[model samples]
Target chain A: MTTAPRLTLPAVTVGDRLPDLPYDVTATTVVLGALASRDWRPMHHDKDFAVDRNGVRDIFLNTPNQAAWFERYLTDWTGPRGRLGRMTFRMKGSVFPGDTMVFTGTVDEVVSDDTGCGWIGVDVTLSVGGDLKTSCHARLALPTTDDDNPWSRSGDRWTP
Target chain B: MTDLSADIEALIGVEQYEEAGEFPVERGYVWSTCSAVENGNPLFWDDDVADALTGGPIAPPTMLSVWFRPHHWAPGRDRVALPLQIHFDLKEALGLPEAVMTENTIVFHDPVRPGDLLTTRQILRSVSPEKTTKLGTGRFWVIEVEYTNQAGALVGVESYTGFGYRRAGSEAGVAP
Candidate 1:
């Protein structure tokens, strides 16, 4: 298996744009995310309930499902050593099956804290056909050197 | 007619409910979640790789709340109710027929691991006055949910915001 390259703190720039991740959303994808997150909400898996009861077009992604997707998107770019500190997102619209959701992100800031933990700020947006569905702001910790692993830090050294 | 505005006003900053997950964190759950998201992070799949970084394998930090999500059905539970009770309470009180999540924020304090029994407590954060938007006339509310492990250490906290609204032409009242 080919391993993804580790992203070092010194390599990231304030304006670096991560590669776009486009996913063809499907009913199965929606249901899988809900089931994996253990969210049994009907709006995420029951099309009839979503259409007839919830008045939505169809079953859409749940909150945790979206969170998982965001995590995947960020970690994919940061490789395995990246650690998420916090994330905030706004859902402006729904993502239905048959829509192609494209994730785009850019590095807004990069900093090294007093504890020597390297942090990267990212702003991401999920859009379908150029219409915004969700916008997320996230902060993540990355390694400063090859031997530096953010996850290995704890106690006084792990303030994120 | 019930005064939803008044009722919701009284609920702000009050603890709505506290509950524990049906089961502890399981490796199978971590696997399924990773598979669903198509994540190939060694931290979630390869123990040796994770051990070098975090002492052992760790669940995705975003899964903090997932560990506390109650099962759909259990032996003792005879009926099914919506997961977040406070959201539905505002919906029913406001006569809103539909609700949608508008915003969410989560702060991760610790990594989750298998066998960790998680519990969550939810509190009503704020409630907005009724306003008309593209979706319809509705009030927005935010709920803060805190997650803790069996040892009572904080794992994460989430602020969830939702809008309960009456669709256009729906007979539901939005209160004066």
Candidate 2:
């Protein structure tokens, strides 16, 4: 397995761009994801149903799938010490099994909490073939010092 | 067919709550599901990689959806309704000839991590009887579910629009 890049809290700030992560949405992939999520929605698994009934040419990506992509993009940048506070996205189009989705984002703002921890806000987007499929804004909290890392200690409570 | 419409109406526009069983953040489950969906990332499976990047054990975004599985109508019932999967099967069983998912949306207010017990409340936002093609007749129903942790913090809200279709010329007296 490839070693993931070293992610540090202080190193990230406003204007940092998350690396583009690529994924292929396939029939087996969509079906398995839907089954794992227990969505049982036909457009996610049944190509015929999607095309014949919904006028979609192929199986489409589900809401959870899009949310996952957004999370992946942010986590790659923030590392573990960073805690996701909130994320909201609006899906604009359907992503099919054959479509390649690229997840990317940019840090838009940063703030300090009362506990002296760092909080960063980001704007994220998912695109296929140069068309924006989804866009989101997210907030995350990170520790200023390694010792202050929230996830470092046991029984540390996470707050939104 | 029972007129669940009234029951549905009473439930509609009014929020009804249900609590889900506790679920651990299982890295294996996340990896398997991501792989099945062709999402290849060491962060989902390799703790070392995830720890190196995030500083702790973390779940993928798709992991939030997985919680919906292993849930049954009754508490403690492990029977999998596999709602999305069953919709497909229901199409086949009813011989309705066709069915489709028109839209779906999920809003995340908080991150769902390991060791979190999720409580969900669902509200039938709306139901609209609609027109369809010759293969069958159908209706569109919108349901929104809010998921909160044991601490009563809202985690996420998932909204789904589902279509149920019946086979042409086969809809006189069949049970829904």
Candidate 3:
């Protein structure tokens, strides 16, 4: 299902903006994503509790849901050849139903790791209704050539 | 009741939770989660697609925290009656009980493949003094969770920050 053009290590630069991704949030997407993340926090699904008790507008998106959106943005752009190495994000605004979350990113830096993997740093922003929902940064590993595959290397050997 | 008087400041380096799931990374959970996130990457569902790349299906890295919940229904770490939220009694001690996660950071070390049982240890990294903000007067804290596999191989580390606040005018400690 990876339809995007596979981006190789040599193709990307430090100022490239990834393809903008748009996702519409509904009650189902919010609840399902929370459940899948094994999150049972009331505010993520219970509208009544979130509004009356928490004073929020409605049932808002949970951390994992936002996290998944960030992951999708990176992997979708990298295609199958790239792998996620690290991700960090800060949630500023709550995302509710009927909100359209737009994900955009710009490559911040590029470096070569010791293990022959190309490391790419991206500064990402998730905005909804002209408001910033989450600001994120991630380091992705890309294969340099057809044979420089990150998938083939396995067995839990990596560092921070 | 009186606000928690316990000296919560003394609990800076507590390991609040060490959690793990009973079963290994199963296909059912992996596929369901991918579907929920709308991640159409074949590496999550199709075996042939994954086998061609990473040798087999792998769990999404975003599910790292999902695999390490509070350990409510597992062995070794059965939901203990831990002191106040954030593991330092600070939330209760300050009369600010409501909490919301404000930020997160995850470092992926390796791919989590099927049949690999995961384990995690959460440590109370830091807790800042009470501060006044638009929401209310609250304290900010950080909890770091380290994940590992069945063979004790390091998997990932997640740092989650939360702000526990009490609305203004609701309590005396709240800011106007």
lDDT of 2 by residue, B20-130 (tens): 744655656676666655555665667786676545555664466577555434676565544244344334443345555666555555555666777776676766654
Summarize candidate 2's per-residue lDDT along A1-25 as a digit string, tens digits.
3442235457777898877878876
- Residue ranges of candidate 1 with Cα displaced over 4 Å: A1-5, A54-58, A155-159, B1-11, B14-16, B92-98, B136-138, B165-176
Candidate 3 i-RMS (Å)?
2.7
Rank the models by lDDT, top first.
1, 3, 2
Instruction: Name the better of 2 and 3 by TM-score.
Output: 3
Compute DockQ for each candidate against the true complex. 0.62, 0.20, 0.54
**Which candidate comes out best when scored by TM-score?**
1
Report the C-alpha lDDT of model 1 over B71-168, residue by residue, as the tens digit.
77788887664457888877777788788888789988778888888888888887777789899887888888888888887778898899988877
lDDT by residue (tens digit), candidate 3, A1-160: 4423387788889999998888898999889888877777788889999999889888988877778778877887887767788898988888898899889999998877676667889999999977998899998888777666666655433433
Among these predicted structures, which one has the highest lDDT? Answer: 1
Error of 3 at B9 (Å): 6.8
Please state how well chain A of candidate 2 matches the true chain A, as a TM-score. Answer: 0.85
Weakest ten-residue segment in model 3 chain B by summed lDDT: B81-90
Docking category for candidate 2? incorrect
